[model samples]
Target: MKKHLSIFKLKPLSMLCFTFLILISSCKKEESDPNEQLQDGNSTVITDLAGDTQAAMGSATPGKEARPFYIFLFRLKDQKQIWIRNATDSAQWLKGKDWDLAFTGPYNSEVYVNDKKYRYNPGFEGNAESAVVMLEQQYDLVDQAPSDQVFDASTITKIGWASSASANGWFFYSLSTHIMQAIPNRTYAIRLPDGKYAKLQLINAYKGNPPSVTDLNWPAPYFTFKYYVQQNGSKNLKTK
Candidate 1:
């Protein structure tokens, strides 16, 4: 007991008060309450889970599938999609062996209320010459080409969107490559949320997971890929 000289056994003063309260909670700096995130209305982290906000930007959905795509008539408000090129309508484009020709039904899409019939089912192809080069390069669709316009290889037309979403804003096609390889194809980074990241790929594909030399992989198949991204200007991501 004569050796007891401890002042409440202070183990170096409780390790310097637990390292000074963890450096004062790591420099106590918290005051970014910008109206608490403008009233906390958040939701934007899907950089393409097949990203389909039903074609954002005001999102009408009066029947769906209306996203910038046109040719000829340009001024705004156009999303046609009629059919019936010819089962006898003079054998126009409705005749096929591998692709093309009145591919979708004929009519009655709810009594054609503002028309919208992107037929060509099964894999899609309503006169698919790359779908008329993505509907005649709707306002240069950001980056489009297939001979940049003038695709009248004997046509008939049923229509395919346009007149809005920022001057004909829709173009997606992939017979295997080009069009920036089809949006974040393999996706190595896409994080976004302030931390920052967006990198995407597919511009030429051929890097890996790809076999079968050129038939594009199975049974003479050729659908390639497609993509779309329009954040801020109204979050649109046509994830391929």
Candidate 2:
């Protein structure tokens, strides 16, 4: 009888040890690898502006000079990779025909995407197919209170003009004597040629610090922003 009891206790202890080993192996397999993350589609990216100082708007004569503009090419879902380019002239812009977004600059504030012009309009809803709408204010960086705002299609209207030179054009940049601002809180909604929707927000234009007249050559034209592109062909910004 004593021998039989010892045998039963040994069996239960052996099973318990086997179960613990299996649990540990399962946990090791479930660990996430950062290197396997997606590089382009359905992911957010930040990049610097690409252009020479000679192409700046106020750097030289207006019509005689070319304004620096950055072009971003987002590949289609069926494609393999993303193509990005930066240009300072019409010829350069022509080379980037596949681009989905444009950051037109001298000051590097205006943004054009999907072959349509956009502006910061506080009152209007931002969701027209042919229009670009953004709010005309800046929110605190740490707070990020504007992220909660709802965005969708049909809430926007097309502005009359193309560039900032016109009276009724989209005014995305704000500059004053004492202060210059980019209205960072504004979020833009756009529909791509591929029938996809995306939401973008401009984070910063300068590299180390905000632009100043005295500090022109501190490695400027760096553009940083966060974007979410809907992968399922839905107009809803939250679907991403």
Candidate 3:
């Protein structure tokens, strides 16, 4: 009779242990769930952001300098777009850490982080610690940011068109077709100046963010990009 009682008590304890393990597994899964993280308001998606869409293609006349247009500087933290005339006074935007990304060059095709690595880059000579890293994986699949050492080793200054055979960038330019196409599954992992991490996906460059544009006259320089800034100051950038 005592042996039977002992066996019954041992079985209940074993079942309790198994139940505790299952609860632990469920808690871990919930903590790491991408959807739950997104629902907590840690992601942002900016679509159809116009980046100098009205600017002319090239110089209008021979021996005449083309009119310079303002560059769009974006602040990822607040989702604000600040316009700065590059030909004129750009010190307020370029010299400060108020901007995270700079949309420069013709049609705003080139992008630069606010790191003081180059003379013409944003936050030049400032105290910003921002960096950019390009990844070949799709945006949704990139759950973790690479180590800070990896960001330090990256050499991608501009995240624009791949002009040459050996160039690495976000878009592909077809010489025959004269079209700029954003490469699929290309995402940029950015280290914000404030020491937080974010993942950016440059979706399209056309006005409507179309999947494919056959017409050459389709209005362009309009950017459609989405990003998720890990707000908890950790590298958990899992945004589904």
Leading candidate by TM-score: 3
* TM-score list, all predictions: 0.17, 0.46, 0.76
Q: What tens digits encode model 2's per-residue C-alpha lDDT throughout 1-240?
A: 996566456777776876687787666545532112212344475545432333444545543345443333333333212322433433333233345554443443444453432343211132322234454433122112122223333344432222353232333343333122344345566566455666565555556324233443445455545566677776555422
Q: In candidate 3, what are the lDDT values of residues 20-48, reduced to their tens digit?
A: 87799889766643233323244686666
Provide the lowest-lDDT 10-residue window in model 2. 139-148
Instruction: Score candidate 1 by TM-score against the native.
Output: 0.17
lDDT of 1: 0.25
The best-first sequence of candidates by lDDT reads 3, 2, 1
Q: What is candidate 1's CA lDDT for residue 232?
A: 43
Model 2, backbone clash pairs (residues 3+ apart or across chains), number? 3
Candidate 1 residue pairs that clash = 68-169, 69-161, 69-162, 93-101, 181-202, 181-203
Candidate 2 local distance difference test against the native: 0.43
Name the candidate, 2 or 3, with the larger TM-score value. Answer: 3
Stretches off by above 4 angstroms in model 3 are: 1-42, 59-69, 86-89, 164-166
Candidate 3, overall lDDT? 0.77
Could you say which candidate leads in lDDT?
A: 3
| Clash pairs (backbone) in predicted model 3 | none
The list of candidate 2 runs beyond 4 A from truth reads 1-43, 53-97, 116-130, 135-180, 209-217
- The Cα error of candidate 3 at residue 208, in Å, is 1.1
Instruction: Rank the candidate models, highest TM-score first.
Output: 3, 2, 1
